[model samples]
Target chain A: MAMIDSTRRSFVTRIGGGAGAMALLTVVPHPASAETIDLPERESAILEAAFGSSVLTPGKISLDMPILAETGLSVPVTFKVDSPMTEADHVTRIMGFAPGNPEPVLADYQIGPRAGLAEVSTRIRLARTGFVYAAAKLSDGTLWGTKFSIIVTLGACVEDIFDLDWQRDAERRAMRAEARAAAAAE
Target chain B: MATIRISIPETAAKDEIVEIRTLISHPMDNGYNVDARGQRIPRHILHTFIVTYNGVEVFHANLHPAQSTNPYMVFHTVAVETGTLEFTWLDDDGSVFSDTRTITVQ
Candidate 1:
């Protein structure tokens, strides 16, 4: 009975030590890698530049877009923030980002107290199927945001053709100019 | 020359919220496409848009290449007194396009 009790005690100690090591492993690398792994570096940098150290709480902003877009050339996006629109408390700025686009920044809007509503609708181009994010900054220095995933069938900004010779471009331009001049003379 | 269009109600009540829609014609070339001859097309896009109401800036937008061609935007503002709303678009090539509309507030 004494030997059995000692074995049980030793096993419990080993299990506790193993659990502690596992917890340490998870805790040590989590915060450093989580942010980098969650978002692309460019997007994270842009958001950091815009919002500073403020945390982007995921609420109070409603971003609406089609779940599946027929094409990435023009996707209609609309966003509204729950704000009083008063001078003291209003949405000061709103920014949109498309992760898959060559240039991630879609648009940045600056709103003033005179804006009766904190809402905007615009068309944006997407390079491929990816996540679209919208973030809003309030007068109180807090930031709120939301993201929507969109599937694009036809992509944009990825055209492949071979007519990039500078000499050819200049010649084409001159020909067009001469044509225009001729038309003007006529 | 770009075609600029502004749509706003001619009149509104005091403190009434009115929607303002604006559209501009431009090829917001994102500088990513190569021509048929394999030449990259230079980027040319309208980078900024601003709306000034009653001599005060109310709404402004910073656009990028991700904005579609013929950028169209709709936003809301309060109608306070009678004033002119000036819409301006600033292009990457340093061209500025502007249009103005007057709104009467009762």
Candidate 2:
């Protein structure tokens, strides 16, 4: 897969830790470099109830998928479904769901007129081989869904990038407090 | 009243891509926290937040108390225009608190 390396490499975001939810990934992501992609039938049924079943066809949506991968913990994914984005055609929300994972709905993002680009990239984990689905909710109250897969090569999992426990945290906080005190009198 | 602080870095590009972060102060209660009576606190949450640009709603949410205490939300939206970012946070009781500040877009 010539496009595989360039694709997976772009998914990393420098958006550092901010919430407790970040640590919940321990049970969710699989090994590093090896990934298996799949999707459940119930997921499509849910969207069919919302968007009337025509949403999964890759009609106007511009999406990139990886044919092969080595990691399941932090895989890069981006999705952009075409829309006029006018009040009549704007996308009200874009939701991602990996049903096999601990959290079914990964994240729901709201988009508005000021949102310049239709493109979105983020790091996600695949527990095993499963389908990852993307859904777009339009302003008109309609739903759409698309499915994609990433083939795994290495099939080995890796440790999480962070544990976020109080032990490691206490050490970091102590150093920061020391620095703040020094700066206060300067 | 509990309130969340929102901050956007100065180095962030105007029209590139940026993650908007918001953290609201709330006991969240989760209906899981019990009172002296051993009764669930009845799930008090600041549900339904609206992010606006120039008086237009850009993003909104219907949040549940199950969301962690002092809920922190971050999402991506590309900036196409320069204007004040207005956030209206609503509570379970229909109470509304709003804040607005102009983004110094270069």
Question: Of the candidates shown, which would achieve the greatest DockQ relative to the real structure?
Answer: 1
Please give the lDDT score at residue A59 for candidate 2: 35
Tell me the docking grade of candidate 1. Answer: acceptable
- Cα lDDT for residue A77, candidate 1: 78
Write down the lDDT that model 1 would get.
0.79
Q: Model 2 misses residue B74 by how many Å?
A: 1.7
Give residue B102's lDDT in candidate 1 (0 to 100).
Answer: 98
Q: What is the interface RMSD of candidate 2, in Å?
A: 9.6
DockQ of model 1 vs. true complex: 0.36
The C-alpha local distance difference test score for the whole of candidate 2 amounts to 0.53
Q: Which parts of model 2 have CA positions greater than 4 angstroms off?
A: A1-91, A96-109, A117-134, A138-186, B10-14, B32-37
Comparing only chain B with the true structure, the TM-scores of all models are 0.97, 0.83
lDDT of each: 0.79, 0.53
Query: Please, what is the TM-score per model?
Result: 0.77, 0.49
> Could you tell me which 10 consecutive residues in candidate 1 chain A have the lowest summed lDDT?
A21-30
